[model samples]
Target: MNLSCGIIGKPFSGKSTLFALMTGEDGGGKFGPVRGMAKVSDSRIDYLSSLYHPKKTTYASVEFIDVPGVSGSETGENKMLEHVRNTESLLAVIGAFEEEDCDASLQGEIQGILDELLLNDLILTENRLEKIKHQRNPQEKDEFVLFSRLHEALEENRPLRSLDLKEDEQKAIKGFQFFTLKPLMFVINIHEEAIPRAEAIENRLREKLANDAHTGVIALSALIEEEIMQLPEEERPAFLEEMGIGEPATEKVIRSIYSLLGLISFFTAGEDEVKAWTIRKGASARSAAGEIHSDIERGFIKAELVHYDDFAATPDMKKLKEAGLVRLEGKEYVVRDGDIINFKFNV
Candidate 1:
């Protein structure tokens, strides 16, 4: 599955800068949306590659669509809405670098962006309901009921994501791709001087969004991250250490997106390839096999699974099997993050 996210923010919020830092693409001057893929950095993948000595190593990635910075004009709003409607999630960048009262400013900016999204979704919901009212199909009745509940929530300034929707209900309105229903993460773009206080700023935002499960917060200096990305790969760690940053902004953002979207990774390793696969949390073994190849899932038999940590400790298939650490799981087995799986199947 393609895990796509839309990057959005008010102009001069460093939205494009963050996008460039994450994807290594400088498309700041573009009038249309810029598309790029950011690889998810995983230590587990690195270890598997080393152990398997694979000729090819692959990391899971997130496709980012950086739309033109949103402005107050209706044209800009409409353009942005058109570009991001199909994305699975959103990353809202808020400027906090130059504000004297960072907390207040951040809160205001967040609320303003959210209000706009709520209004956009409200309009769509209202229009759809109006159309449904004129339709006589039996299916329209069910759609009208579901949309009515959505409209009630949107009308009250509540995000549709806050609603506990069932699987079929989600599918019914999936095509609409309501803005407020997608997972969202707020990226607080701080200044170099604010690095020491990054934790506090993130904590404040987290507190504000404590009740919103679909939303998350992270603080990073886009300027610093851009600088870090420009350096040689071998020189990055020293620079990060000097800057007192624990992890690169790109990695943090990628991981944050995964967590916000309820995603996990499982691995398939061998001499030819060591690759990471992304799947929704609680996905079954058969479902994960399908992510690799439909034939593997179709001829499903068992998943020879071993946790990464267990393999890392033994680092020997013979020893692992002797210890009963490698076991076969059925199609219904729930795949876990960092699970090294070898699907046993015949096509």
Candidate 2:
């Protein structure tokens, strides 16, 4: 899956810097929007690549879009909000660095952005509710009831995702794209020294927003990430060890995203193409085939599969077959993480 995440934050929250670090894209300076794809960097792919030494390997990637900084001075436009809606997920970078005298307007600016989201959601909810109310037919009364329940929840400062909407109620609101209803991961960008306090902030957020399921918070040091990104790959571990940084911000961010978004990865390995594919945790064999190609999904017959570790140890498909580690799964079978699948599709 091409899972795209957009970075949004107030001015100087390091959204652009984080974007550059994640994407390895040079936008000249940290001003305008910057977008690029970064490899998912699966070790299984590396192992398979080494085993096969194929002509090529394809790494799964996440697209990152960095919007220009927003501050109290700037006008809160719908453009940025619209940009966020285009993505599969959102990463809101909140400034959490230490300062002698913190600017009072920072929180207000952040709230302004959030207010925009609320307003956007509010308008959508109102419009949908109005449409249901105006439907003259009594046969659609049950449908209108769904919208009414959702409308009440949205008006009461509750996101549609947060409310325990029935399956049919969820289907009712599907046409109204509510901004606040989407899953959001908040990245608190802090200074280098603040890295140690990252977990503490997450704890605090969890305590404060105990009921909010659609949102999660994580603290990251963007400046530190930028520094780490500039270092040679071989030297990174030593540098991180010296600084007591466990992992790069990029890895933490991606892992956090995977967890928050309920995403899973299944691998396809060979020298020709060793790749990791993203899917929702319970996605089926046919759905995974569709991610690779629509034709494959249309013709999907079965999936020839094995664990990455099994392939790594044996280094031969025939050996895996003999060992009984390789198995064939039908279209209804759910894709499992680390599963190395060779889709058997006629198309």
Candidate 3:
């Protein structure tokens, strides 16, 4: 899947800096929106790459679009919203290190962005509801009911994601692409000096969003990420160790995005290629096969599967088979994260 996420925030929220660090693209001097892909660093892929010594190794990635900072003006906000409406998810960067009323200010900033999303959705919902009121078609009737429920939720300051809609219901309004329905993560940008207290800061910020569904909060210092990015590749690990940073913030952000979006990866390993394929959570074996090619999904019979952890422990295919760790799964089987799958197909 080609997943894309938009980086959005108020002016001076360090969103551009975070974008640069995430994508390794310095959009500082650019105008409008900047786009780049960030590879999701997976240890399983790394291990498989080493084990297979593939001629080509590919990691699953997410595209990040650094939208120009949102402004107070309606036109500016609308333009920013337009840039992000089609994105699968959003990362709202909030500058948390310099505010005098830090906690309160952070809360306000989060609410401000959320209000913008809610209001925009409300307007769309109301307009659609009004237009369909005079119609009598069955499809329009279903939409009227859906839009009416959405309008009520938006009016009550609720996000569309909070509703427990069925699969068909979700498909019905998928085209509307309501901002409030997308996965959102709040990236609290802090100063390098606050690195030691990053956990505390994240916890506090998370409390503010405790009630929001389909939302997540994480804290990172963009300055530190910038420094890490500037370092030579071979020396980056040492730099991170010296700074007492367990994992790079960019990795954490990518992992969080996957979790928030309910995505997982399954792998196909061989001498020719070792690759990670992205798929939605709870996707069936046939659906995962389609990720590689439609023909594979069409003629799929079964999946030869082994969990990555089991393979890592044994490292030898024969040994894994001997231990009964490798199994055959049917087309209806749900693919799990880190599963190594070889589809049995004929087309």
Kindly list the per-residue Cα lDDT of model 1 for residues 174-197, writing each as its tens digit.
Answer: 998989988999999998999888
Task: Note the residue pairs that clash in candidate 3.
Answer: none
List TM-score per model, in order: 0.97, 0.86, 0.96
Ranking by TM-score: 1, 3, 2
The CA root-mean-square deviation of candidate 1, after full C-alpha superposition on the true structure, stands at: 1.3
For model 2, state the Cα shift of residue 84 in Å: 1.7
> Which residue pairs show backbone clashes in model 1?
none
For model 3, the run of ten residues with the poorest summed lDDT: 22-31
How well does model 1 score by local distance difference test? 0.89
What is the number of backbone collisions in each predicted candidate, taken in the order shown? 0, 1, 0
Error of 2 at 323 (Å): 2.7
